[model samples]
Target: MAFSETVKHEIMVKSARHCCVCHRSKGLNIEVHHITPKGQGGDDSADNAIALCFDHHADAGHYFAGHPKGSKLSPAELKKHKESWFSLVSQHKIENPKIASVEISIMNKDYPGFFSPVFIRETTIYTDRNSMRKMFEFMGKNPDSYVEEFKARFPQNDIYGKHKMSKIKTYDDLMEYFNGDMEKEDREKPNTDPQPHKFELSPFMREYKVINKSNCVLYLKLTNGDKDVLEDYKLYLNFENVIEADSVTKRSKFFDDYKYSYNVFFPENNRGEFIPARPVLVQNDSVTLDAICFRPDPKAKFVNLNWELFARGVFGSGTIRINIKSSFEQHIRERHVEPSEIKPKFIRILPKWNFE
Candidate 1:
């Protein structure tokens, strides 16, 4: 029988990755020894195993083979060492500990593209003192002032849906909950209460003019109108009725071949670099995205371009809509009209046309 990885990890965490007898970190040589020798009817349980360094495994004074007669540590003494070490580790963890980040994907079953979204959030295992107290209280333990101090420093949000709080008995259990493997209800469900955080899109101008007949630029300002600061909010942009033109023909004869080509840029820098449509952080009362550049095929005629912006945060989510009218003012030489006519007939036309 061998100790499972899960049990081994739990023991290691509780022991602070050190030998129970000598209090030495196992750099390259760590062994899990059975307190009651396996030969003497010991099962491979966590309570029956103790982590030891190479020196402590063979130390004559603490652990020895064949029942040495002189001052050797009994199984009872090893159990005491394991208990004391785990307590020390737990106390140190309550004082100062590293936190784990968990990312959960939330999707609206009705709206796949618009509603399905994933958010990366840090867990409250290390920072939420009140949560720890709640766990202890659930276990019938009296919580001390340390829990209050933790609650003051790191506040917990109600955005997380109802969780099985009583199941969390230790810090490891709290981490396991965030890792998404617990036998609990849906984790992505929003709270029953409405969140106060709000987001809005503010267009810089109502209309934009196309430059060089083929290129145009527009700006939309994203503002976090919420009272509370929104952390790690993401912005997404969608464009419609835009297509890419072929370099060889300079235009596509078929309408299906034409696609939208555009770029987004930060107005402050304007380095001519295109910002990929990725998630961006929007602080409370701060503007996130400043500008967007729209470039269409040179051969395109008058077309109405549609733009949609979506935003999601810990508190709430919303969408904004924008429309841009693109019309070409330049005229190209006519091939059907005779050169000798008093004036060649001029008409608004798109270089690319589909013959039906």
Candidate 2:
């Protein structure tokens, strides 16, 4: 959680692996040193970073207050060196083709957190009179802690099925009917409301909440190479080799629900509006799309997200390969990540009519 991958990439490209202090190319033997120590309240930001060679880093990092041998590099001095080198690189003192080559990379490891979707399920029960009465009476008394144990297994919220909203009350309603001639008039059974003679029914409702899961959340990085500014760009994407079992990332109803040919989402979205990750870009600017959580489908063995970006006078396209297994591994901390196999808890019953 130090300087973001985007910030580090930008600083590295700006410095070209050269030590800002000694001005020597260290190749990969360079480090982005913090101008202000973190414990001293330094923030993980580009302006607070300065690239340095190993030797200079050690020199700048080592200093004993009581046994001071020589003056260490000052924060102001580091900032000046970094600014001078960055300006020189950008102003053509040493040309870097990377400056003009747009690049995109998925920094999954760089991101520390992941997004998770939720599940909502509801089931209805049906049966004949005597069976239903027994069931309700059982429900009213909750023998053997069946209801509590059942909920403990599935872990869910409920509706009127187990509360005051129910049409039948085990004693007040059912026994009251039993005290009347209604049973004799009907005869077949007592408490005959929607006869619970059978103890089975059909599935009623189930839902998955995945809209936010399709957001662009991660240390996903994109850099603009051209010196000209990029403006008013919309990103278009499509998934391939997907199945119904896959997570909503692939099954996105975006095309059908929103009339977009490809899956489209606003960058850095907040209630469908843009934040920092705007639809605009400037020269040598690297953007970390961290505002939302747009990820690969969780059940597909392998998937591809083909993307196309278009601006007023610019167009770019590429494909992002998704490894389903790796996707779940990446979010091992999630409570209910796909494909969830918590041995789902449930009580089965068959119904006659469909529930809406």
Candidate 3:
């Protein structure tokens, strides 16, 4: 009999969506296998199921035929592997529940007497098991091929910097190289120029409004007002008291006490991708943006929070400071209160033409 949904979910969760035998993530392909053949009286229980990647599942002396009988993995052997994998996954999740994502913003830094527009492509990488496994497999198989693919995706230019191809032999080497690059970038200074070109808020930006605010939820709308095309515009929020929580803070003292986490949603078009703490591309004239502050302290009656918004794009960059006073009591009392629309009190825009 086929495995039930509950059994499948249990197996996947326990194994952390990875192959039990090889400990490989489920990026390439993962399959659920029966420890004991149903014909031998095995029921569809999670204990009887094991996860395996395509490579290990079909390998000789494992699950398929054409291997010596003694070399084949028995049901007991599969169970042992599954138990070990589950234990490791449980420990990992306890130590690190969520992975932090990285984003490198690509922008043109304006330098005096230089009219050339520098092409900057910021790459974001998530260091999850699946992502790590994919990088390991690809780089280990052929580092040159991986480098070529990256170059194709983000073409290097003379204004920014050259793309140095990495020569990595093992998974450890690849990870070391990646971490080194991230450290170097972190040490570098901010991309924005010291003397930014200033401009008044465009018509679209002037018309922007705050639709509503509830218990930790803020809704917004943005419309493109410039005639020139705007690509890869981002909304950056820097919170005052609530530091953006991440897995790195799992051991920190403030991890539990931190009352809020930030996330964005594009309600107008579901197709748009929302990268945490990164900009979402807006192509249309208008789009609805939702900022969700989750995991509020239930005991607290009111939460006073402050954040700043930094908007960046090819056209220019701008910054705005905002303060919000939210009360759970008020929200509870007036659940159906109309949205409180507000304008951009003040906006400072740095245009691209000034640099040229």
Candidate 4:
């Protein structure tokens, strides 16, 4: 991950848009360089940032000890220059915030110069037997894609090799296979609930696809609102009153079972609107499927997901709130043997940041 917009903006102001190396105002023709390279265990923090004119930045960036170069900028030198320039800027704070500003380069990006201390990206989903049936029905048209997506969501049961999946095409046959597999797992790890999992599917799928033991299953989004491509980005999640992120088997943990998620979701490729979430590629200024299934504190009216987006050129923290206390309780009440009764849906997919 790289310096966040917050830190970069601060560095730009502290240096008064001047490259600390040359000590001359270069406006937006400057790049913030890390005093100590990230490879050397440096972090994307304000203290590690130094503004350098594009020309000096190129020079300071390239250094080979094997071929001793002229005036190679060292970490110590960068710190000294940054401190000296910051002191000078403080002595003479520019009256105009925009004059000789480094952020002019990003002006067209409509960069939100300041971000909220906490960003709340919230959503809710409601599921019951009918929703499950609808989910499967939606997936019936293309069982092959379902199998691949199902594998991504539940790798443990994806034991059916691709070569064999083509043989099992119908939705009913797929469910039967899953139910049998569920029994297989039950035979290994006996469950106190219904012996065969009458939901018409396997225990593995039930555990993840249906939020039977969790408050709700949701799809979260990771957005690169900036035009810059966020390279080597990692999205980390901290689940409060959420389940642990350990896998019982060698297979990767399922959505509801995972606390540490690095997977991406692509709805377009799969019948995403009707199926569960899973995937992993990203681009600049676009949105993709990227989130969750959880066994949360059901009693808590709202479960808060503390998330950190770490990527080169960007980083920040935010919370995705899933208000579930009432909906979950209602679901528990409606979870009876009746197809006519509808389950209360809490599909709180955030409108502000969803892929249309």
Worst 10-residue lDDT window for candidate 1 reads 191-200
lDDT of 1 by residue, 1-356 (tens): 78875666566556756788887765335677778777667789998888778776665234445655756666777889888877877777422112112121222234222211111122222233245556777978665543334334544521343344444455545444544445445443432111111122238533222122232333444455544443444333433333321112112233333223333322221122223354443343434243233334333343232222222213222223223344433433322211243242435434222111
For model 2 the TM-score comes to 0.31
Q: How close is candidate 4 to the true structure, as a TM-score?
A: 0.30
The sequence of per-residue lDDT tens digits that candidate 2 reaches over residues 1-356 is: 68875666667778866788988876557789888767667799998888999988987775334336658776777888888988887887764423234566677665434333221222322223344346756669543344344445643322323432132333334333333322344333321112111222236533333232222233356678877677765454455543211111222332344233112243221111222346678888877643223333433455565554555445455666654432221211112212333334343322111211
Score candidate 1 by lDDT. 0.43
lDDT of 3 by residue, 171-277 (tens): 44434445454235535453222112222245665422221112233334455554433344544333232212121111212234322232343222111123334
**For every candidate structure, what is the RMSD over all alpha carbons to the true structure, in angstroms?**
34.1, 18.9, 28.0, 19.9
> What would the per-residue lDDT of candidate 4 be over residues 323-346, giving only the tens digit for each residue?
444232221112221345444543
For residue 192, model 3's alpha carbon misses the true position, in angstroms, by 58
Please, what is the whole-model Cα lDDT of each candidate in the order they appear? Answer: 0.43, 0.49, 0.42, 0.48
Q: Which pairs, if any, clash in model 4?
A: 123-348, 124-348, 264-279, 265-278, 265-279
Off by over 4 Å in 1: 60-66, 93-356
Model 3 RMSD vs true structure: 28.0
As a whole number from 0 to 100, the lDDT of residue 265 in candidate 1 is: 27
Best by TM-score: 2
Residue 196 of model 4 has an lDDT of 15
Which lDDT value does model 2 have at 66? 39
Model 2 worst lDDT window (10 residues): 328-337
